[model samples]
Target chain A: MSVTRAWAWLIALTATSTAVAAIGLSGRWLALVVLALAWAKAELILNRYLHLAQAPNIARGFALGLALFMLALTSLAVAIP
Target chain B: MTTPQASVLDDLPGDLMMWVLILSELAVFGAGLMGFLAVRLTDPPGFAEAQAHLHSTGAGINTLVLVTSGWLAALALEAARAGRRARLRALLAGAALLGGVFLFLKAQEYADLWAAGLTFESHAFYTFHMLLTGFHAAHVLAGILLLGLVGWLATPRAVEAGAAFWHMVDLVWVLLFPVVYLI
Candidate 1:
C-alpha cells in the first residue's frame, strides 16, 4: 500500500477510535473495539510506514506479539467490571 | 549456500541495529501498558475517575499529528534515496515540525492536568500516566533531534535510520493513546 493511503487510513482509524470514546461509551466491548483499531493502526505503521512488509518473518513476529498483548489487554478489560 | 530464508533476512531494510532498537522500545512500552491494565484491574473505579480528567481530544489530535509526521518521514526516505537532498531536508523538517506540534499539544494537556490537581503522587492511574507518556514524550524529543541530524547529513542511511525511529515513536503512540486516554 502507498504511504498516502496508509496515512489516510491511519487518520480515519484514529478518528473512529476517538469518536467511540467521545460518545461516552464504556465497557469491555468498547475496549475491544478501540484496542482492535489500535492494532490495525500499528499494523499500518509497521508495514506501510516502517516497510516491515518486505521482511515477512519480522513482520509476522511483530504482528503475533501485538496480537497477544491486545488479547491480554482485552482479558484485563473484561475482568475490570 | 545461503537459503532463501537467510537471503530474505539479509534483505531486511535499514540497519539491523535500528530494528533491534525498535524491538526493544516496543517491548518496553508494551510492558508498561500491561502493567497499567493490571493496576487498573485492582481499582477500576478509581482508574476510571482519573482517566476522566484526561483530555482525550487533545491526545486524539496528537495521534493525527504523529501519523502525518510519520508519513512525511517515509517520504523523506524516498527523497533521500532518489538523491533529492533539498526535498529530503524539507520533508524531514516538515515531519519534525509536526513532532513539535505534538509536543505542544502534550504540554498543554499536561498543564491542564496539573491545574486540575492531578499529579504522579495522586494515584496509580496518574502515576502511570506520567511515566508512560512522559517516557514517550522524551522519545519524540529524541526523534526530532534524529530527524534534524539526518537531514543535515543528507545521507540515505541516516535518513532511513532516522525515519525508522520516528515511525517507532508514532507506532507506540498509536497503542499508547487508547490504553491511556480512551480505554
Candidate 2:
C-alpha cells in the first residue's frame, strides 16, 4: 500500500480503538476487538512503514511474532474479570 | 546448480543490523507488555480502576501524531533516495517535530496523573504504566535525535536506517497504547 493510504487506515483504526474504549465497553469482546485492531496497525507499520513487504519471508516472520504476542495479551485480558 | 536466486536478505530495506536492533527492541517491549497483562490478570478490578484514571484521549491523539510522523519519515527516505536533499530535510524535520508534539502531550498526561497522586507506588498497574510507557517515551526522544542526525547527513542509507528506527518507535506505541490505556 502507498504510505498515505496506510496512514489513513492507521488513523481510522486508532480512532475506532479509542472510541471503543471511550464508549465504556469492557470485558472479553472489548479485549478481542481492540487488540485485533492493534494487530492490524502493527502489520501496517511492519509492512508499509518499515518496508518489510520487500522481503516476504521477513514480513511473515514479524507478522507471526506480533500475532502471537497479541493473542497472548488478548487471552490474558479475557481471562481477567 | 542453477544460479542462486537473490537472497531474501538482499530485499530487506536498510541495514541488516537495523532490523536486528528492531527485532530486539520489539521482543523487549513484547515481554514487558506480556508481564503487564499477566499482572493485570491477578486483580482485574483493581487494574481497571487504575486504568480509568489514565488519559486515553491524550494517548489516542498521540497515536495519530506518531503514525503521521512515521509517514513523513518514510517519505523522507524516498526523498533521500531520489536525491532531493531539501525535501528530505523538510520531511525529516516534520517527522521530528511531530515526535516532539507526542512527547509534549505525554508529559502533560504524566504531569496530570502525578498531580492527582498516581505514582508508581499507587498500584501495580501504575508501576507497569510508568515503566512501559516511560521506556517507550525515551525511545521517541532518541528517534527525534536520530531523525535530526540523519537529515543532516542527507545520505539515503542513513535516512533509511533512521526511518526504520522511527517506525519501530511508532509500531511500539501502536501496540502499547491499547494495552496500557484502553484495554
Candidate 3:
C-alpha cells in the first residue's frame, strides 16, 4: 500500500482506540486495546511514514531505544497493578 | 549540476533535527504520564475526588479540538511534502489557532477552579490535577510557538517536521484526557 493509505489506516485505528479509551473502561480489556493500538501506530509511523526502515545504523538504534522506552512504560502499567 | 545534490544533503540534517525535537518532546510527555499513573495509583480516592472538580464537558470539547488539530497537522505534512506552500501555511495557522483556543479554555477552567477554592495545595488530588494540566498547557503553548516558527521559516521540509511534532502533542492529550478525567 501507499504511504498515505497506510497512514490513513493508522489514524483510523488510533481514532477507534481513542474513542474506546475515552469511555473510561479501566480493566484488562482497556489495557489490551491500548497496547494493540499503540503498537500498530508506533510501527506504522516509524517504518512507513518516518521511513526508519531505511535509516542508518545509528538512527535505527534510536528507533529501538524509543521502542524500548515505550515497552518499559507499558509493562510498568501492567505490572504495577 | 551541484544544486540538487546540495539540496538533498540539506534536507537530511533538517529532517533529522525535526525527529530529534519530536523524540525529546515525546520523552517529556511520557514522563508526565508516568507521574500521573504513579500518583493515581498511590491515591486513587483522592484523585477521583479531585477529578470531580474538572468539567467533563470542557475536557470533551478540548479533546475534539486537539484531535481536529492533529488531522490538520497531518494535512499540513502532506501539503509540505507535495510542496504546496500556501496550503501548508494555512493549515499550520489553523492548527496553531486551535492550540490557542485550547489554552484559553484551559485558563478559564483554571480561573473558575480557583474561584471555587480549588488550588494546587488544596489536596493531593488537586495537586496532581494542576500539575498534569499545567504541564500539558505548557506544551500547548510551546506547540503554538513552534508552529509560528515553522511558518516563519517557511521551509517545506521544516513544515512537515513541525506537523509531526504537533501531531505528537495532540496524541499525548488523547491519552491524557481519559487518564486525568474519566479514569
Report the CA-based lDDT of candidate 3 relative to the real structure. Answer: 0.68
lDDT of 1 by residue, B25-75 (tens): 998998999999999988999998999898899999999999999999999
* lDDT (Cα, 0-100) at A56 in candidate 2: 91
Which is the leading candidate under DockQ?
A: 2
Which ranges of candidate 1 are over 4 A from the true structure?
B1-8
The interface root-mean-square deviations, each candidate in sequence, come to: 1.1, 0.9, 4.8
Please write out the lDDT profile of model 3 over residues A1-81, one tens digit for every residue.
445565576657656665775666665566556655665655555554454555455446655766675565565455435
lDDT of 1 at B18: 96
For candidate 3, report its TM-score. Answer: 0.71
Sorted on DockQ, highest at the top, how do the candidates line up?
Answer: 2, 1, 3
Indicate the worst ten consecutive residues by lDDT in candidate 3 chain B.
B5-14
* Candidate 2 structure quality by residue, lDDT tens digits, A1-81: 899999999999999999998787878878888999999999999999999888899888777888788888888878864
**TM-score winner between candidates 1 and 3:** 1
Clashes of each: 0, 0, 0
